[model samples]
Target chain A: MPHVQNGWYLAAWSDEVGRTLTQRWIAGNPVCFYRLGDGTPIALEDRCPHRKFPLSLGRLDGDVLECNYHGYRFDGTGTCVGVAEQQDKPRAATRRFRLLERDGIIWIWPGDPDRADESQLPDTSWLASPNWTHVKGVLPLKARHLLLVENLLDLSHETFLHPSTIGNAAVAATPIEVTTSGPRVFFQRRMVGVQAPPFYEKSMGLTGLVDRWQDGEFHPPGVFLLNIRLAATGTEEPEGFHMKVLYGMTPSTENECLDFYALARDYAIDDAELTTFQHEQQLSVMGEDVDALEVQELMYATERRRTVESSIRSDLAALRGRRVLQKMLAAEAAEESGGAVPATR
Target chain B: MAPAARTAGDSGQRIGSPGADEEITVDVVRRRSVADDVLELTLVRPTADPLPQWTPGAHVDVLLPTGIVRQYSLCGDPGETGSWRIGVLREPAGRGGSAWLHDHAVEGTELVLRGPRNNFPLVDAERYVFVAGGVGITPVLPMVHAAERAGRPWVLWYGGRRRSSMAFLEELGGYGDRVRPRPEDESGQLDLATVLAEQEPGTLYYCCGPSGLIDAMRSRCQGMPSGSLRVERFSAVPQPAVEEPDGGIEVVCRRSGLTVAVPPGTSILDAVRQAGVDVLSSCTEGICGTCETTVLDGVPEHRDSLLTEDEQEAGDTMMICVSRALGDRLVLDL
Candidate 1:
């Protein structure tokens, strides 16, 4: 999909960046990332010009990124400060990206830096507010970024996929709807006869009745939040049933993704309890997804199918997601080709 | 009239950094019985992948076949272009890294190793005092030899349970009168204070020993100038028991929404791992900064020797291994 060049992309959680230069991919290109003194994110081309060594193989000197191969130092703009071999100075500057920090998330402009917009990043005002706790983690997923984006949008799988936690056995889909707004795609799941799963049973206090279910909306590239509620009075009684899990999926590579999350809910759980609970849940779900999807990727490599088909109604949101992504990718490819016929019709 | 800077301002002056060394398969491995407990492993990399050149204080990160990595000091001369030398002290209570090196690893087995990075180096000093204890002598041995070659006034304070326990007795004797091999020289222990008293004005006191010796020297050498005293601790200092969390507390991993209960004996690190969070950690003993995690919230009982008291008090850093949550629970920025 076409990535917004100037718009913020989560580079890494603050905890992930340290003295060691870590390599991450953005928009299908590898970039080595490091943190500045105040935990600001900096991104540069992963390859060092001295010997084309991976810059992540280097070290961090305060704000300067040092190439591990020959101690070449590059500032935030990615201009080579010092090359160990003095004779190679005439033509040795690496490409630099526009890096920015909002809250604890690091963002990089992988495309045209001239058009990057720092203001477009999702408002993380919840991070500053009281009655909310946050935790940060980094997961190196062996799957395409689009695959992860689609995975989050397809929330119906949770009934079977996460049976013990966020799932329910009797929560058959009564109706599934898809709607779209500018830069946002909404996926709503409605379960008619849903019984409370054991974990949520005690937590929600809806032990007997059909606890109403509605998880809506998937904001493109990567942002998923379900305006969920247990008791469906149909109008405004859906207060305590909703949780906002804003996720940012930054592409690490063509075959890897870095998922950053911020969970804000109206629960009275203490900071420690909320933070640890969400962290543990994310880990379990991520482990399951990583195992299943990496294996799927391996299988996809070997099996080249001529045609793939599915009933559109059963999983309409997933299908629409793929179509929207195809359109974005086509537009990007056309722009790259100077307005030629796009990659796909 | 500009004052000459005592410390090197530029990063260029930080010597003994690792360079581009090709990954080589182990062509040969030789185990030597130096002491009753110590085992020396000599790994020969391919000629094409020439061993990474190292200085005296440098160590290598060895990747064993079992996927465990351990850092060991280069005991043999770093100047040697041949195989690299590392002495492994078989820690009985080790989490299988060193114990595997002592028991199972053998000759002709291929291995991956990261080289010769030196955080502890013998700086330019007029006179050197090398104080070593047990396997801690690995780094000091090379310093003793370098001091002897430079004709720099040096004394070796080697202490162990007995004379046989010392790693490099043969090399220490070459120093002649400079070597004070204190196996049991009587007078109730090799008093490091007595050794520090004879220090001249320009003398540099370098001590690589157990935590007790390093702590004692550090406390006694307080009056010495800042750059005069250099200390390296091989083990941890004895501290109070880590305060346990009350009951089995819930750790709300905010990013994931999964709650895991951390049992009394089990550490937060283990609990995090159990929940399947991928945290990069090393030297679980709290010395190395590999397991250094950012503290998002909660008062971290700083058990690690890596960060200073100020860093701990700032509530931003923590070592995952030995340290525990002081309050009911701690929310780590994983």
Candidate 2:
């Protein structure tokens, strides 16, 4: 199935793109990202539309790109504005994807331009909020974006996959409950009087068997958020630290993804040591994930037989998320083929 | 950003239920009365093929053809992949799962099962002390073999009502003094005081049996080092009622014209049942979603693991077995 074109997918971190032209792949389509002199992020199809020369290989002047092959200049909208050898710049434009830069991330919509809705953007205000201390990073994921989505949605695997970092017996041992609304899927695991993992024990100062909560939500096409709580077991009041973790799976191809992750905390807002510790530790953890997922991607591509995999309780959210995206793709296909009439045979 | 965080808007809610691993149909290759009133069945893959690998403390969820599901600990050798063995004690007063198995299970019987899930895994330790009571020996049997194979210094304290009624005595005889068989008729209650004295640095204690034995071990574990003891209950121990900090709440059973007060130190399930409401409940500790009740109004301060955060936040349905109302009042669909 093709990528969910109408949906907003994260393109690049705001600070990652500046005046320099950078070519990035999205849903198997290469797109160039750069900022105009006004510091506004722009996303345009990398091809020149004429000779299919990658525009990203060209030079940038103020607010426009000059193709390297023929020195053809195009505006931020991928509209060809000037040509060095030809008169009357052909009224041709490479595809321009809509871009939205909000909360330190640039999001792009590659579908029908008129249908882009800003309200549908995920709420990531916490990333820029002063009340939360955060660490963010990205990985060139070598697996289907859905696999990463499934990885985040199925927290049960954490106990096994991330044993040294976040995984612990309690994570997989505790069961999860799934609930969904519309195209969104959510699953929560609450541990009442359970032993805290080492990460929680160190970061949140949660020791012994503590009351904990982990809730995950998946927004169709590629957004995942986890809300975590660690509190003293049987505490009369909600007394503990809270952490908000986010994962963005932007599909670059069927076997490749751009994984964006950010972890924000309500406590230790000014603890630089903790920030550095978490940043380094999270990188190590994600490195392990990428290693496992890359192998999986290889298996997913070359496997010949129909595998006998089964879904259990913890897979409810992952399964539901896949179904929701499937529905979106089905609707798009039906609409695209709606007007075609066939001749009588 | 959410308008009251309602989960039922435009999106239908599906209550999550406990699901098992992929089902595997196996044949009951052999059956025998391991002990008085104790039935032992050996299961193998239908084609007499090797089964999935399992560890010491793993148990299989037997989904009987009658639609009833029961769990039995694997008692056979974990090294043997071609078959698995389980022991079931026939309880006359208990549910009919054991009775059905006792009568219907035979050499040719086919049973569908899920998992060999290990909740009571044997964590690596310098030394091990295994305490088993009667049928609980089923789980401990493999553990004994594992501890021996690992060359870990270990001892097994096996207890039952009578020597004749206890299973695995003949097999355990191979262990010599490593296995201590304490029949109640022969040794009066197994001396827990003597066992407690066996505690030492780097010693890990594992126990499984009736609530009495487990509770006793739990009480004595306080004197031992923290995390040194691990025990698996046959079923979820009844969770004691504790008042939410928000205090007691009034629940209106929408189907029935009755309002029940769930007070501090009282569970909503117990309170409703006490109020003459007959509700079906199983695994009352909240893992099973059998006691899920629809919430027509008011918020539920969810304490159960069966409902997702969105479901709890939606204030739609709740597993009343452990969850309570968040506010002072709740309207339930009964």
Candidate 3:
């Protein structure tokens, strides 16, 4: 019925939250993110309890936030530390979310504090490793998080949606294998002895037929890891180009989501020009996805009722991923209802 | 040019009462003295609804309890939606508006406000130079936060009578050297000439202060570049007169289809309003750009301090309150 709360969502990039208080929305809740004197990042509800003024509008005295409105101050723990000319601070406090900084990203947990588990955080170690060159970008999408999740889980759209860069007719023409292990859904597609896409041609210097393999894994509530390898045809050499593209979709509202994407590569680690070129190419492809998803969202809004839709063989991975999310949501609802056995849709 | 007979019976609308709009009431939840005479008032909507969103450099027109309307910059962060903050400097020798706000406006008082209009908007630049004096620091406060958030280089030269007279000094201290607080007593007068020297190519200058500081910065920035300096003025500056036309000015209201002749000593706004054409106006002086009218076919003698020289030269729009027609017959969009 609503967004699954007991999960990690990307709050912002590591560099975005700094000395000054920054405000962002996660799961339709306003959040204020800032760092302490020792550079420890903190996430708290943006609204002040006294007059509902955003703590971000306030100034920071070390780690304490002073509300610019009436001078109400809050500590890093969201406790009311001081009030102007008043002693004995009231019990007024804002909600403090669990925040973790890892792998150049800040993760926030807006669910029950006791249920927050650090182990559940997505693995993004490649983005921080010096061995791999990475380029990251953030896009605010008008579509729902589920729509973006589906868009990333299915690779067939690449052939049509992204024709210039990563797209080719072979991606849609080739059959894909779908499998699931626990909460992870995997989609594997192989195109052998096919023309190299324009993106690989320019980036990898491939001018002839090549063997391309795409293996994507979806980890809910919204993380997609796509591993791609391209090598010369009829050769199993060790000099093939490999890339790891990671996507993290965090829902800002019911109908809005923030897409955080990082493209990492093991090859061409020293080429800054290649990194810039790949960054622009990735941004262009993502822009195309956003355009398509926004239009799909508009169609869904106009047609309130869902009609009978046809599903192809390539949609198996997306369907499986949706089912996993549904199970998670149902389990969360059941737990909240004191294990009384909630109805599953 | 032929002289047209002046048409009479055209009465202008009274000032302050523009039209009937929804009255949004906000309660003064908190008030505190931040400086010697400056007070910061935090106003919040009584209902649970979020207040109107505003950007940096926007100001709201507050209708004081004494029925006096005054515009104050929303100095609070634009990210805050629940409350709006305004800093007021108590003027002893001037209008009673600021005095009434200082003496009577207190916490828990409810005030009706009209707008959060932004006449001074911050544009994108590689670097920014902010010069504020006395109460003029209100609008520049939020802009500094914006520049910091954007990770752009900026320097604020804030001047007041004394360090104790400046509001938000404690808050500005967090920014460290980026904010230069110049108390007139300790730092002498602001050496705007030296500070503004060696200007960068894409550096934008924003100055809001007394007339002397504004004029000094204006002259210093004359040779820099066009549209490089943006200054907000509290009072209107005297505009040079255009060569007078041979006849009385004829203004044709395109929408209302009324032709009125405005003789010498009469403004085009008064002439148009006299013909039952209602045009919104605030601050009858050309300072407030409220009575700005679009020009269809006319060369306007621009007198308002709102538009830049290039904008006035384009002649697409003119402030009808003070500026008049340069030719005998002119057409107005009305």
Report, in order, each candidate's fnat: 0.00, 0.00, 0.00
Best by lDDT: 3
Model 1, A13-100: lDDT tens per residue? 6666765677777767678877678755667788887788888887777777778777787887788877655655435677778876
Docking class of 3: incorrect
Question: Can you give the lDDT of residue B102 in candidate 1?
Answer: 73
Sorted by lDDT (best first), the order is: 3, 2, 1
Q: Which ten residues in a row have the lowest lDDT in candidate 1 chain B?
A: B1-10
Candidate 2 residue lDDT tens string, B1-334: 0001111111122221134266778999899998999989999988887788887876776776766667787889988999999898887754567778898998999998776666567778999999988788888899899999999999999889999889999999999998999999989887888777856689888887765786677656643444576665563311112113457888889888889998887888998899988887766766556687988776566776545333443456788888876446778988
TM agreement with the true structure for every prediction? 0.46, 0.51, 0.49
Off by over 4 Å in 3: A339-345, B1-334
User: Residue-wise lDDT of candidate 3 within B79-166, one digit each (tens)?
Assistant: 9999999988777654567788888888878898765656467888999999988878888899999999999999999988899988
DockQ values, each candidate: 0.00, 0.01, 0.00
Best by TM-score: 2
lDDT for A278 (candidate 2) = 81
* Model 3 chain A poorest 10 in a row by lDDT: A336-345
